[model samples]
Target: MGAGRPLEVDLRRVWDAILYINKTGCQWAYLPHDFPPRTTVNYHYIKWMTTGFFARVNAEVRRRVRKKTVETRNRVRGSSTVKASRAPQNLPKNPALTVIKRSRAESIIL
Candidate 1:
Protein backbone atom coordinates (compact mmCIF):
# COMPACT_ATOMS: atom_id res chain seq x y z
CA MET A 1 0.00 0.00 0.00
CA GLY A 2 3.00 2.27 0.53
CA ALA A 3 4.69 1.28 -2.69
CA GLY A 4 4.75 4.75 -4.11
CA ARG A 5 3.89 6.86 -1.12
CA PRO A 6 6.49 7.84 1.43
CA LEU A 7 5.21 6.10 4.53
CA GLU A 8 5.90 8.09 7.69
CA VAL A 9 3.59 6.37 10.17
CA ASP A 10 0.83 3.79 10.28
CA LEU A 11 -2.40 5.46 9.16
CA ARG A 12 -4.64 2.81 10.71
CA ARG A 13 -2.91 3.15 14.06
CA VAL A 14 -3.27 6.92 13.88
CA TRP A 15 -6.93 6.55 12.94
CA ASP A 16 -7.54 4.24 15.91
CA ALA A 17 -5.85 6.71 18.22
CA ILE A 18 -7.97 9.52 16.90
CA LEU A 19 -11.09 7.39 17.36
CA TYR A 20 -10.10 6.63 20.95
CA ILE A 21 -9.67 10.33 21.61
CA ASN A 22 -13.06 11.19 20.08
CA LYS A 23 -14.79 8.32 21.90
CA THR A 24 -13.39 9.27 25.29
CA GLY A 25 -13.64 13.04 24.74
CA CYS A 26 -10.20 13.36 26.27
CA GLN A 27 -7.75 16.22 25.72
CA TRP A 28 -4.96 15.41 23.28
CA ALA A 29 -2.39 15.62 26.06
CA TYR A 30 -4.26 12.91 27.94
CA LEU A 31 -3.84 10.24 25.25
CA PRO A 32 -2.68 6.90 26.63
CA HIS A 33 1.01 5.95 26.42
CA ASP A 34 0.29 3.08 24.04
CA PHE A 35 -0.64 5.52 21.29
CA PRO A 36 1.63 7.96 19.51
CA PRO A 37 2.30 11.36 21.03
CA ARG A 38 -0.76 13.53 21.39
CA THR A 39 0.62 16.15 19.03
CA THR A 40 1.22 13.60 16.28
CA VAL A 41 -2.26 12.17 16.58
CA ASN A 42 -3.81 15.60 16.73
CA TYR A 43 -1.79 16.78 13.75
CA HIS A 44 -2.89 13.93 11.52
CA TYR A 45 -6.47 14.14 12.80
CA ILE A 46 -6.76 17.80 11.93
CA LYS A 47 -5.12 17.27 8.53
CA TRP A 48 -7.28 14.29 7.68
CA MET A 49 -10.44 15.73 9.13
CA THR A 50 -9.95 18.93 7.16
CA THR A 51 -9.44 16.92 3.96
CA GLY A 52 -12.52 14.68 4.57
CA PHE A 53 -10.46 11.52 5.07
CA PHE A 54 -12.43 10.62 8.19
CA ALA A 55 -15.68 11.09 6.29
CA ARG A 56 -14.47 8.69 3.59
CA VAL A 57 -13.39 6.13 6.17
CA ASN A 58 -16.72 6.47 7.97
CA ALA A 59 -18.72 5.94 4.78
CA GLU A 60 -16.69 2.86 3.91
CA VAL A 61 -17.17 1.49 7.42
CA ARG A 62 -20.92 1.98 7.23
CA ARG A 63 -21.08 0.18 3.88
CA ARG A 64 -19.12 -2.77 5.24
CA VAL A 65 -21.35 -2.89 8.32
CA ARG A 66 -24.51 -3.03 6.23
CA LYS A 67 -23.01 -5.76 4.04
CA LYS A 68 -22.06 -7.84 7.08
CA THR A 69 -25.48 -7.38 8.67
CA VAL A 70 -27.23 -8.62 5.54
CA GLU A 71 -24.92 -11.61 5.30
CA THR A 72 -25.49 -12.51 8.97
CA ARG A 73 -29.26 -12.20 8.63
CA ASN A 74 -29.20 -14.47 5.58
CA ARG A 75 -27.05 -17.05 7.41
CA VAL A 76 -29.39 -17.03 10.42
CA ARG A 77 -32.43 -17.40 8.18
CA GLY A 78 -30.83 -20.27 6.33
CA SER A 79 -30.01 -22.04 9.61
CA SER A 80 -33.49 -21.64 11.11
CA THR A 81 -34.41 -25.26 10.39
CA VAL A 82 -31.28 -26.60 12.13
CA LYS A 83 -31.81 -24.10 14.97
CA ALA A 84 -35.22 -25.60 15.74
CA SER A 85 -33.86 -29.13 15.52
CA ARG A 86 -31.15 -28.31 18.06
CA ALA A 87 -33.46 -26.54 20.52
CA PRO A 88 -33.11 -27.93 24.04
CA GLN A 89 -36.30 -29.53 25.36
CA ASN A 90 -35.19 -29.57 29.02
CA LEU A 91 -34.62 -25.82 29.26
CA PRO A 92 -36.52 -24.10 32.06
CA LYS A 93 -38.48 -20.93 31.24
CA ASN A 94 -37.18 -18.33 33.69
CA PRO A 95 -38.67 -14.85 34.04
CA ALA A 96 -35.22 -13.20 33.98
CA LEU A 97 -34.42 -15.05 30.74
CA THR A 98 -35.63 -12.13 28.64
CA VAL A 99 -33.10 -9.70 30.08
CA ILE A 100 -30.26 -12.19 29.77
CA LYS A 101 -31.29 -13.12 26.25
CA ARG A 102 -31.50 -9.48 25.17
CA SER A 103 -28.06 -8.68 26.57
CA ARG A 104 -26.52 -11.68 24.85
CA ALA A 105 -28.21 -10.82 21.58
CA GLU A 106 -27.06 -7.20 21.79
CA SER A 107 -23.50 -8.26 22.45
CA ILE A 108 -23.51 -10.68 19.55
CA ILE A 109 -25.05 -8.18 17.15
CA LEU A 110 -22.74 -5.38 18.16
Candidate 2:
Protein backbone atom coordinates (compact mmCIF):
# COMPACT_ATOMS: atom_id res chain seq x y z
CA MET A 1 0.00 0.00 0.00
CA GLY A 2 2.92 2.36 0.58
CA ALA A 3 4.49 2.03 -2.86
CA GLY A 4 3.64 4.13 -5.96
CA ARG A 5 0.20 5.75 -5.64
CA PRO A 6 -1.28 5.81 -2.14
CA LEU A 7 -4.35 3.84 -1.13
CA GLU A 8 -7.82 5.48 -1.46
CA VAL A 9 -8.92 5.50 2.18
CA ASP A 10 -10.07 8.88 3.48
CA LEU A 11 -7.64 9.96 6.21
CA ARG A 12 -10.34 11.47 8.37
CA ARG A 13 -12.45 8.35 8.17
CA VAL A 14 -9.46 6.24 9.09
CA TRP A 15 -8.69 8.60 11.95
CA ASP A 16 -12.24 8.26 13.23
CA ALA A 17 -11.96 4.51 13.08
CA ILE A 18 -8.69 4.63 14.98
CA LEU A 19 -10.26 6.76 17.68
CA TYR A 20 -13.23 4.45 17.89
CA ILE A 21 -11.05 1.38 18.26
CA ASN A 22 -8.84 3.05 20.82
CA LYS A 23 -11.78 4.26 22.87
CA THR A 24 -13.63 0.94 22.82
CA GLY A 25 -10.55 -1.29 23.06
CA CYS A 26 -12.39 -3.80 20.89
CA GLN A 27 -11.04 -6.72 18.93
CA TRP A 28 -10.31 -5.80 15.29
CA ALA A 29 -12.96 -8.23 14.06
CA TYR A 30 -15.53 -6.51 16.26
CA LEU A 31 -15.20 -3.11 14.55
CA PRO A 32 -18.51 -1.94 13.06
CA HIS A 33 -19.25 -2.54 9.37
CA ASP A 34 -19.84 1.15 8.71
CA PHE A 35 -16.08 1.66 8.44
CA PRO A 36 -13.78 -0.27 6.15
CA PRO A 37 -13.47 -3.98 6.78
CA ARG A 38 -12.01 -4.39 10.26
CA THR A 39 -8.82 -5.97 8.93
CA THR A 40 -8.13 -3.11 6.52
CA VAL A 41 -8.63 -0.49 9.21
CA ASN A 42 -6.56 -2.41 11.71
CA TYR A 43 -3.74 -2.96 9.25
CA HIS A 44 -3.55 0.69 8.27
CA TYR A 45 -3.79 1.74 11.90
CA ILE A 46 -0.89 -0.47 12.89
CA LYS A 47 1.23 0.56 9.94
CA TRP A 48 0.78 4.27 10.49
CA MET A 49 1.16 4.11 14.24
CA THR A 50 4.27 1.93 14.04
CA THR A 51 5.84 4.16 11.40
CA GLY A 52 5.42 7.24 13.64
CA PHE A 53 2.74 9.10 11.67
CA PHE A 54 0.74 9.76 14.81
CA ALA A 55 3.76 11.09 16.71
CA ARG A 56 4.79 13.31 13.81
CA VAL A 57 1.28 14.71 13.47
CA ASN A 58 1.10 15.36 17.21
CA ALA A 59 4.49 17.08 17.34
CA GLU A 60 3.72 19.34 14.39
CA VAL A 61 0.34 20.29 15.82
CA ARG A 62 1.85 21.06 19.22
CA ARG A 63 4.63 23.16 17.69
CA ARG A 64 2.17 25.26 15.72
CA VAL A 65 -0.11 25.71 18.71
CA ARG A 66 2.77 26.81 20.92
CA LYS A 67 4.03 29.24 18.28
CA LYS A 68 0.56 30.79 17.96
CA THR A 69 0.27 31.07 21.73
CA VAL A 70 3.66 32.79 21.99
CA GLU A 71 2.71 35.22 19.22
CA THR A 72 -0.56 36.06 20.96
CA ARG A 73 1.24 36.67 24.24
CA ASN A 74 3.78 38.95 22.55
CA ARG A 75 0.99 40.91 20.85
CA VAL A 76 -0.77 41.40 24.15
CA ARG A 77 2.42 42.56 25.80
CA GLY A 78 3.19 45.05 22.99
CA SER A 79 -0.37 46.35 22.94
CA SER A 80 -0.22 47.18 26.61
CA THR A 81 3.06 49.01 26.19
CA VAL A 82 1.81 50.91 23.15
CA LYS A 83 -1.28 51.93 25.03
CA ALA A 84 0.93 53.40 27.72
CA SER A 85 3.00 55.36 25.18
CA ARG A 86 -0.04 57.31 23.94
CA ALA A 87 1.65 59.65 21.41
CA PRO A 88 -0.05 63.09 21.40
CA GLN A 89 -2.57 63.49 18.54
CA ASN A 90 -1.21 66.89 17.42
CA LEU A 91 2.54 66.30 17.78
CA PRO A 92 4.73 64.86 15.01
CA LYS A 93 5.21 61.21 15.83
CA ASN A 94 8.72 59.86 16.50
CA PRO A 95 10.29 57.78 13.73
CA ALA A 96 11.01 55.13 16.39
CA LEU A 97 7.28 54.98 17.05
CA THR A 98 6.59 54.20 13.36
CA VAL A 99 9.27 51.48 13.40
CA ILE A 100 7.89 49.92 16.55
CA LYS A 101 4.34 49.92 15.13
CA ARG A 102 5.51 48.31 11.91
CA SER A 103 7.49 45.63 13.75
CA ARG A 104 4.53 44.82 15.97
CA ALA A 105 2.22 44.49 12.96
CA GLU A 106 4.70 42.21 11.20
CA SER A 107 5.06 40.08 14.30
CA ILE A 108 1.28 39.62 14.44
CA ILE A 109 1.18 38.42 10.84
CA LEU A 110 3.96 35.91 11.50
Which tens-of-lDDT digit does each residue in 1-110 have in candidate 2? Answer: 45698777777777888889889997777888788777778788888989999999899999999999999999999999998789656877799999999999999999
List runs of model 1 lying over 4 Å from the truth.
1-7, 81-110
Q: Write the per-residue lDDT of candidate 1 for residues 1-110, one digit (tens) a residue.
A: 54695867787788889889889998888889888777778889889979998789889999999999999999998799789989898887795988899999999999
What lDDT does the true structure give each of the candidates? 0.87, 0.87
Clash count of each predicted structure = 0, 0
- State, as a TM-score between 0 and 1, how close model 1 is to the true structure: 0.57
Global CA lDDT computed for model 1: 0.87
Worst 10 residues of 2 by lDDT: 1-10
- Candidate 1 weakest ten by summed lDDT: 1-10
